[model samples]
Target: MSESIRNLLEQVKNGQVSVDTALLKLKTKPIDDLGYAQVDLHRVVRQGVPEVIYGAGKTGEQIVGIISSMKANGQCQILITRLSPDIAVYIQKKYEMTFVESAHIGYIGDIPIQKTKSSIAIITGGTSDYKVAEECAVTAEFYGNKVERVYDVGVAGIHRLLQNLERIMSAKVIVVIAGMEGALASVVGGLVDVPVIAVPTSVGYGTSFGGVAALLSMLNSCASGVTVVNIDNGFGAAYMANMINHIGESK
Candidate 1:
């Protein structure tokens, strides 16, 4: 259960809040209908993480409205992914937020405190893949996981990746980001005992098919522990990595 639900139940047991009042709160708190968007107010209660705004197609006003509803429902921190710098500027005028242009991610309110000691390693095959890698790093950090970034370590430069063996080996989870054949994920997967999440970026020549080639390459990886996400889906990779990193930790 969420902290709010547990506290509410405790209050009812101690007669601080009437049972009927608590019931009413529970019945009405799950969703907030805004016509344009049905803001999920109870996602934190169910998934331990609040709803994240996808700002690609959303107007600045719509994003602000969702943030308003979330804040009114007691969600202090909000994450907005795939947000454009222009929309970010418009949102910032109303609410103070940090925007990362490279990752196209926005943060509202303070980042959560770290919940575990384990760290997540993010490795990028080439400099062109840094944008996707940054998204993974920011998402993982926002979720309170310590992140170690080893960028431009693609298989082309095998020595560079090998030099970072200690950092990669010590991580609880690893996110390997690459484009142009995407062989880096398999290489890392073979060396690490932990799970490897592969993200294929749209950063290659004409024949890459906008990351399809890399995605297929990762899916067909020979390594045992390698897993693949959709093209440029850093947020998904980070979410799964954070879950794996926090396993057995007290929520």
Candidate 2:
């Protein structure tokens, strides 16, 4: 059983909660059907993380309604990825949220306090990859893990990455965000003992095939620890990294 459920049972035993109320809380439906959205209320209980809103295809009103449903179900922190500034403005009228333009993320509620001593490192191949790197950083931090950012360290200038060897080596998990040939993942994977998640962005030229080339390159990485996510999928990379970073630690 989850800690929250155990605490609820304890409250019932202590007479702090009425039996009917406890039953109602326990019997709460895992999915809240909100017509347009079926919000997963039991995700936190099952996965130790809440369901995140993918804001790209959603309108402001739909997003607001989902947020309302989540809030009503006692979910405090919400993460919205690929959110636009305009839609953020519309949602801001209803609830306070921090919108990060670079990462295109909207966050509701306070970032959780760090949960573990080990950290996740977010490394980028170039300045252009900062957008993806920021997305990984924000998602990792929101999940209560410390993040170290190492930007503009692609293989083109091996010295730049070499300079941050300490930070790279110390991380519990590392996320490598890069475009073009996406060779950074292999390089970093070869260097770090920890897991390396590679993200390929659509920032390269025509021959790059809109990040497909990078995606393939990363998929074929020779480094043992290297793993690849979809093109421009920073959130997925961070989510996996968070799980690895939090291994053996309490949620």
Candidate 3:
């Protein structure tokens, strides 16, 4: 059960709230109907994380409406992915927002402090891949995980990657982002003792086929613990890394 439901049940057991009152609280509608969208209000109850807003196709007004509803319902923090700076600036006028231009992500509130000792390391193969790496770093931090960033450490120069051996090996979960064949994932996977999440970005020449070549390369990685996410799916990789980092924590 969710903490909210557990607390409500405890109140009933202690006679602080009547059974009917408890039942009413439990039976409240699970969605917020905003005409354009029916936001899932009980997602945090079902999963540890709450719903995230995808801002690519959403209008600024629509995003504001959804955020308003969530705030009214007591959600303190909100994450918005694939947001443009123009839209983010418009939204920021109404609410405080931390906008990451490179990652194309926006946060309405401060990230919660990490709850675990295990940390997530985000490594990028090249300078071109920093956008995707930043997305992974911000998402992991938002989910309450300490994140370490190691950038421009692709296979083209083994020395750059080797220099950060201690940071790479000590991380509980590593997110490797690369393009142009995506060999960095396998390289990092070989070095790290923990789980490795590979994110292929569309940051290469014509032969890269907008990250398809990298995607295939990652899928066939020889490293045992290397797992691959979809092309440019930084959020998905970070979410998986966060789950792996908090594996032993009590729900």
Best by lDDT: 1
Candidate 3 C-alpha lDDT tens digits along 1-251: 55667777889999999999988766767799999999888877676567899999999999999999888887778999999999999999999989999999999888876456888889999999988888888988888898999999999998999999998889898999999999999988888788999999999999999999999999999999999999999999998998799887665
Q: Kindly list the per-residue Cα lDDT of model 2 for residues 1-251, writing each as its tens digit.
A: 45577788899999999999999987889999988899999888777678999999999999999999999999888999999999999999999999989999999998877456899989999999988889889998888888999999999999999999998899999999999999999999898888889999988999999999999999999999898999999999999998899887763
Candidate 1 wrongly placed segments (more than 4 Å): 1-21, 113-115
CA deviation > 4 Å runs, candidate 3: 1-22
Name the lDDT of candidate 2: 0.91
Candidate 2 residues lying further than 4 Å off, grouped into runs, are 1-3, 6-23
How many backbone clashes does every candidate have? 0, 0, 0
lDDT of 1 by residue, 120-173 (tens): 999999999988999999999998888999999989889999999999999999
Q: Which residue pairs does candidate 2 place in steric collision? A: none
Evaluate model 3: give its lDDT: 0.90
**Candidate 3 weakest ten by summed lDDT:** 1-10
lDDT of each: 0.93, 0.91, 0.90
